[model samples]
Each structure stands twice: as C-alpha cells, then as structure tokens.
Target: MSIELPQRPFFLAPLDRENSGVDFLGLRQANLDMMGEMIPSINNVTSYIRPFSLLSWIYWKFHDLCTEAGIEEATSDDLRLFRERIEVLFTWGASLHETAERIPGISATPPPDQDGVKPLTFDAWGRVQSSTSLIAALWYGPASKTVTGLGFLSPVPGRGGFFRVSRAGAALAQALDNKLREDGERYNRLLGTLDPVEANESDAIALWSLWSPETVEHEEMASFSSALTSEEAIGSNDTLLSRRSTTFALARHHLQEVGAEQSIPKIRRGMCFSVRPDGSNYDVPTTLEECRRKWLTLQMRQLQRLALETLLSWCEDQILRYDVVDTSAMAERFKKSWALTEYGLGEARNLAELIFKLDTKSNSVEDFIRSVNTNDLPDPFSIMAEITEKFRQRDPGFAVPCFFGLLQCASFAGAENAPPNMVQLGSAPRLSLRVLRHRLVGLGDVTVAEAFEYILEAMVISQHFSTAVNRFDGRNQRLRLAIEETGLTALVSSAWVPTVTEDRLAMLLTLSAQSDLVSKNFDGEFFSNGGIKNESI
Candidate 1:
C-alpha cells in the first residue's frame, strides 16, 4: 500500500523551505556568518514580509476594501487618486498588482488634475530601471511618450469604460450568440433560451436541446419534420409524425405570445420567450418566474463589477503603499512560488520578448493579441540567429543589454531524460568577502537598519541621497563609483536573473549584506562545507 500525505497550506510550504539553505556564492552564506555573534533568533524568527504573504497581500486587500462592498461601489482613494492603477489592474489584473505596488511611490496617487511628484527616479544604469520602465512611461509619463521597453503594449489611457453589462440587456445578447434564437423582425425582443408557451418548463428545455445546431440537421429530426410536412401519408398513418408535430406545437404558441399578427408559421424553429408585448400575451414583468430571473441578472452584474476598477478605488490608499520590493528577500524568491494571473499577462510578456527581437518594428497591437489567442510564438533560438545575422554590421551589444535571455536556455533540465541540447546553469562562480562595518564620520557606530535604509533611499533620489536635506550629497558619487567599478551588466529575460554578472552580484551581495536589516542572527553551522552536506535542518 502507498502512503498518503496530508496536503499542506499553500503559505506554509515556502515559508519553512526558504528559512535556511546551503548557499554557495549567494548572500545567505555571508549573512549567516556575520549574524552568528549578534543574535541567535534571526534565522528562527517569523516574518510578515515573506514572499507568498506579500504577493497575496493585494488579494487580502481587495477582500478587505473592494470585493465585500463590491467593485462598482468601491470608493478607495487609492483607486480614485490616479487612473493608472485602474489601467495597470486591467493589464495585469489582480495577480500582478503586487509587482505594480512595489515600484516605490506608485501608490502615491494625487487626485486627478492635481500636482504630484513623479514616481520612480532613474537607477545606477540611468535607464531601463524601475523608474524609467516601459510600464512607468505609460502609467505616469506624458500622453505623447513613446515606449519601446518590451514592445508588446501601446499606451491606452482613459478610465471608466470597463463595466461590461449593456443597458439593452446582457442575458438576451448572450443567448443570441449561443444560436438559441432567430434574428427575425422580432430580434432581441424575443429571447429563445427561455421556456416556450404551452409547454411545461422541462418540455421547453427538451425541445431546445432537440433543436440545437448540432442536432438540428440530424437525419432523425429532419426525417421527423419531413414526415410531418409530407404530402402523402403522415396524416393518420404515421404515429411518429403525430408525436413530432405535438412536440413542435410549443414553438407556434410562442409566436402568438409575442403577438405575431400573421397566421401561425410552420413549427420549424425551437422554444422562445417574448420580451415584446402584445394584447394577447400576459404581462411578463408581473410573472413571478420572469421577475426572479431579471433580479438574478442584476445580482450577476454586481458580482462582475466587484473585480472592476470602480469598486477597487474605495480602499484606503495606505494599503497600496507597502513598498518592500527589493530591500527585502522578495527579489530572490518570487519565481519559486508565484501567484498566477488571469490577464494572459505571461503570454503577453512572452510575446513582448518575441516582438523585441523582430527585425521589423512595424508589428501592430492587433498582432500581439492575435499571437496571444493563437499562441503562435516564433522560435526564439531561430530568431536569435536571424537577428544576430541582421545586426552583424551593427554589433548591437547583446552581451550587456540582454545577456540574461541570451544565456544558455535550460527550461527542460529537470526532466528525467532531458534533451541533449538543454542544460542548467553551470557551477557558481567563486568570490570572496570580509566582515563589513561603517561609522558616522564624527559620531559612533552606524546601525544595520540605517545602512539598508540609506541604500534604498539612494535608489529613490534622482540626485544625491541625504539623511536630511544636504547631509550626503557625496554619497551618490561614492555609490555610483562602486556600481561602475563592479561594472553592472544588463539582462532581460522571461525568467528573472541577476542583471549583473556573477562578479557584480557578489560585489553587491557583499555591500548589501553589510546593510541587511534582518541580518541580526545567524546559524553558522549551515555555512560549513561538511555541515551543509551531512547535516539537515
């Protein structure tokens, strides 16, 4: 007999797994060592800002402010302050709003037509950073800005058309598309999905099922209709013809219910209900069944609006301001246990990557949508060869700008009998580190929290960073010089990779570690080579 294991909570599995590990050249090794003497509780502590919890915060936030009250009814100033939040939500939907929120100051929406500081200043590289990202251009920059960042999107701005229900009626239109009714003069005024006159509800449903497009032309139903309409013998001799005519009688009754003035038409069509009124027909609005179904239609409309921007805008803007994207461990862990999206955002991202590599820049937004529906992606490896040949004269530096995607693809490495051409990333590069410390020039020891905060603040500033206004105008020069010496390379890929080379990653890892806010305790035993191999924690 096989053993069965109980399913684990989605949140707990990752929380426990990432708590400790044998990291070779990564920050974990060095961080473990430094915190060993400072505090024993670091690795053992719980965190509010772990990867899974943080990604799902938006969902919980919606439940708190939007879904309960309903999206159409939402008055969240965060949703109302800037229209970009609505646009981003529609593009990325509920799943990707977490990433949007993390781009510092994105939630700081000033009310429409009012002054607000621009979110996202440039990064160390000066462009292609979070502040200057393609999303930011469309979300915050001027209406005329052109974006080439990933290449799949066009700037579509304007708010409040997202609601889908029409004033004419949703159920009638939906039923029409299903081929349940005829497009005669009666048109949308006669609904075909509902029960027909002179037939019990179940009988109307049976008549509808028997008359569908798939079975409408079936030999059996066609023969039945032929026998009923035939000139010779169906009158008193054919019992089947008599039953078939009885079955189609309800359709004829329904034409009368809609007040058709002509003589009863042949009972060739299926069951239908009339929205149009005639003196012979009873009032539909007063009928209990008709009134209930319309009320149900209203209920569905409310449910649909819950996920739209109108309801989402009612939240307290404060919940959208949670900004621990890169300073925390979130940057390193999102890939393993990601929240999935319904916006086709992944396929959109894939198509964006494919479009960026195309020789001609003439593709349209329609092309992207068509490719998404068909999933007809051009082979990237073949595209790489074609692009390289085209750029041979230019030598456009893929080595720096897109080295991440250009690196060896190993998407199939874990398969038991992996294809010979596919392989995982090779061994970690070797690096060295030393214990790090800093002090104020005239004062005493600088705290770890202050150090991490300084780097984060530096990233936010367009010019020099400062504790107060003019405290460290020179810090930008020092940080810029360090990044320049480390020689930050560029990378854009379907999956996340360190934008910098391994050497540069180590350089920042060492620098960033000395500033870690949570690096207060370490279990150094995990750092030993034998301890990593032989011991399990």
Candidate 2:
C-alpha cells in the first residue's frame, strides 16, 4: 500500500507556495508610498483620494482656472468634462507658473516651495511629477473607478450625455480590449477541444448546481394561472414567482417554506400558454412537466442574469481602474491572488468586448437589458453562475476576487458599480478597514490580532477623510512634497509575504451586510470585547 501524507492546514501552508502567498503587507506599504506622492500637504489632506477622483479634481480645477483667465468657455453641460477639456486644463495647469494669477489676491505670489501645493503652482517638472503620481495612483487604486472614469454617462438633470477619453485613458481601454481578444481566442481554442453538446451540457450543469440544490423534476414549480385568476390572491405571495434573495440562508429558508417557488412556476406557465380565467387556454400545454421545467428554468435565468450583470459591472469597473498592463508588484499581487481567475479573466474580456461595442454615448441598465436577446433560449446566467461557482471552488486565486465583488456590491447597495462615493451609505471600500476589524483578524497571513490592527491602522492613516469639509481645498503643496520623499518604499519592497487562512470567507456575509460606509456600525464581538472603535468617518 502506498503511504499518503495529510494535507497541511491552510494557515500552515508554506508561505512560498506557488500561488498561495499573501503579500498584503508589501502592498499596503507600496500603497502608502504611493499615497505619499498624492497629497499637496500631510496635515491638510489625506492621500486616500483615488486616481479618477484625482483626475476629476484636476479637470475641474483646470476648468475653473481657465474660465477665470477667459481662455476657455464655460457651459453647464456635464458632457464638457471629457479629455479634450482635461487636456486643455492639464496644459494650462502645467504652465500656470509661467503666467500671473488671474485672481487679484494671489496675483504676484511665487510658487510656494512646498511639497503639497496644487499642480498649477508647480513648474514643468513638478506638473509632470504630479501627473505621473496620479497615474501611479491609478495603477494602485481600486479597479471599479477605472471603468466609470472612462465610460460615457447617460444624460440626467443638469447634464447632457458625456463620453471623454484622455490619450492615456484611451490607451488603457485599448489594452483591455487586446487582453480580451487574447482571452477569447484562448476560450475558443478550449471550446474546440470539447464536444459541443457535452460542453454546453457540462456548462449548464455546473451553473445550475450553484443556483439550486434541487434537481429539475416533471412537476410544475409554481401555480401560474391559479394565483392570477383568483380574486383573493391578486396581491398575495402566490401571484409573484420565486424572488431569489442574494443570501444562501434566506434562499434556503424560502425553499423550506414551500411558498414562492412552488407558486410562481404556475403563473409563468399560465402566461406562456395565455391561459385565461374563462377556463379556455389560448394555447394548449405541450406537457405540464415540460412547462414546469421551462418556468423554473426561466426564473433561474432571470436571477442569474441579474447576478452576472452585477458582477460584470464590478469587474469592468475594476479593470478600468487598474490597467491590464500594470506590472507593479501591488497590481500583480492582487491579480494573482484575487482579481484574475480563469473564468473571471475570461469574463473580464467579455465585459471589455461588450463595453467596447457600445455605440451609444450614453448607456443605462435599460439599454443593457434591451441589448440582450432572451427569447426562447437557455438562460446565459445559469452558465455564468456555474462558471463563477466552478472557479471559486477550484481556483485558490479566486478568493480575493469573490471578496472584492462582495465589497464592491456592498459599497454600491445594488447601484451600478460606478466610482465609489465614500460618504455614501453603502461605500464598502471606505468602510472596509474600519468596519471589518474582528473578522479581518486570523485571515490570510494575518496570524495575530496585532497584524490586523497594524494593517487597519495603516489603511486609515493613508486615507484623506474629512469630517468638516467634503473635499480638499487644493492648496497643500509642502505636505504633498514631504510625503513623496518619505522613503517608506524601500522598507515595503523587502517585507515578508504570508500564507492565507480559510477563515476570511467565514465572515463574507457579515462583511457584505456592513457595506454601508456611512453607518456607525461595529462588529458585535469587537464592540463587546471593548476593542477600539473604527474612527475612520
């Protein structure tokens, strides 16, 4: 008999395992180093502002200055905030030191010999430095903002539609396109190796497993016509089909109750055949079992579609925030650890292609929904769900991406994953370090409570939160300059990497529930234990 060795515990897994090391400490340091370069002053503003926000801030500042100088025309049109305007603003801001200030009070003032001054006051080299710093910040920042920064917004009040791309932003978008093309070619090659029907069935089977534990049977899943035709049940639960909740527990609870899912299928089947209250069917039922199956299948399809769209939205946003070609240790570490799964990589490409194909300058959920054709076909969402579940199980690399999606969604609270608003109720990113204290301990390379505390404290210190003002005044040159030369980079580059434990996923639901950034929430255990409160806000 062959001897076998027991699998090592996840926490004790060798730190140098091919793909299991967590270099969050190193990433944290690099992020800190990057933050040092972002601020105009140390005491005045936090370096927590991300790249697109930095770009937007620059764009708006440049616009204000140029308008003051009578060089650029000002319109209330939101669409005017694109790259052309950005470029004009950048050029003007870069060279502002060469001309007198338009505002009377600051007219004759010299460029402050400070580190954190506004880019407009900086010399040519300083302007370039500031731009480069923003670019680096983009490279280090969260991925969700990238998509929104480059995408066209649909028209809303006080704004028409606008689609703007800087040369760099356009290049980043193209890089994503090329990456997607490569992924598509790879998936296609994989497809060629499998039997078409078997492959389709396999994909379907995989996705269906994640959607529900129950097998499809010949019975009707729900009462379609009975619920609708009855006067007493019109607004009751019987009329509505299985409304899938995001949580596995709630969904399981619903299943145990034998309520929504059992009734909704009948309503769907009734509608499909145009069954009327007159006891006359406009169309005959082919088979009750088949109709039931179809109804159940349709519901799964809709739920899965919604979930996939939500995930894809988050994915694209992350991709746009971080470029495919980013080679920094931080970017690569995140990609290898969490962001890039085999399926997720493929999905990212699909999202890129889908986004690139958009001809409309302004796009919305309705537009996205209209673009997909769902008539008389198998549910695509089921396949996606299967893919997501498959990779999440087999791919150790997928853990972080799963966590990230959860975090992103928590930040948005079902809104489209656009740029995050820190002050928003659901801003998970802003609140992640603050809210997820007790749970964050014993996760990944974080062995001791002190490790978690150190990381959390670092994240808070690195951010630029303000209770008094909503934004920085763009006037802290000395502080910004000082942080740039802080010399923390050398120490971070040499930090140790650690193995991750499985406990991180244990609190996934709790973390998801705490996505609201503005809430004065605390982990119950952390609170009861008298742990220091999250003072980030």
Give the distance in Å from residue 84's predicted Cα in candidate 2 to where it truly belongs.
74
Worst 10 residues of 2 by lDDT: 219-228
Q: What is the lDDT, from 0 to 100, of the residue 463 in candidate 1?
A: 19
lDDT of 2 by residue, 102-217 (tens): 11111223333334422222232233322333332323122112232222111234533222334333333333233323445432332112111112223323332321112111
Stretches of candidate 1 off by over 4 Å are 1-52, 72-419, 422-500, 503-537
Q: After superposition, how far is residue 346 of candidate 2 from its true place, in Å?
A: 12
Q: Model 2, stretches more than 4 Å misplaced?
A: 1-330, 333-366, 374-388, 391-393, 396-537
Q: Cα RMSD (Å) per model? A: 33.0, 29.0
**Local error of candidate 2 at residue 503 (angstroms):** 24
- How do the residues 1-537 of candidate 1 rate in per-residue lDDT, one tens digit apiece? 344543873221211111111221232322222222111111221111111111122222333444444565433343322223222222222222333122323243222221331221122113332342322322222111123111111232443311122211122123223333343322222222111112122332332342221222222222222322222221222333232222222222333344332211111111212222332223222222222222222221111111111111111111122222232232112222222321222332232232233212213322322332243432223323333442333322211111111211111121222211111111111111101101111112333233223322222221111212232232211111111232321111111111111111111111112222101113210010110011111
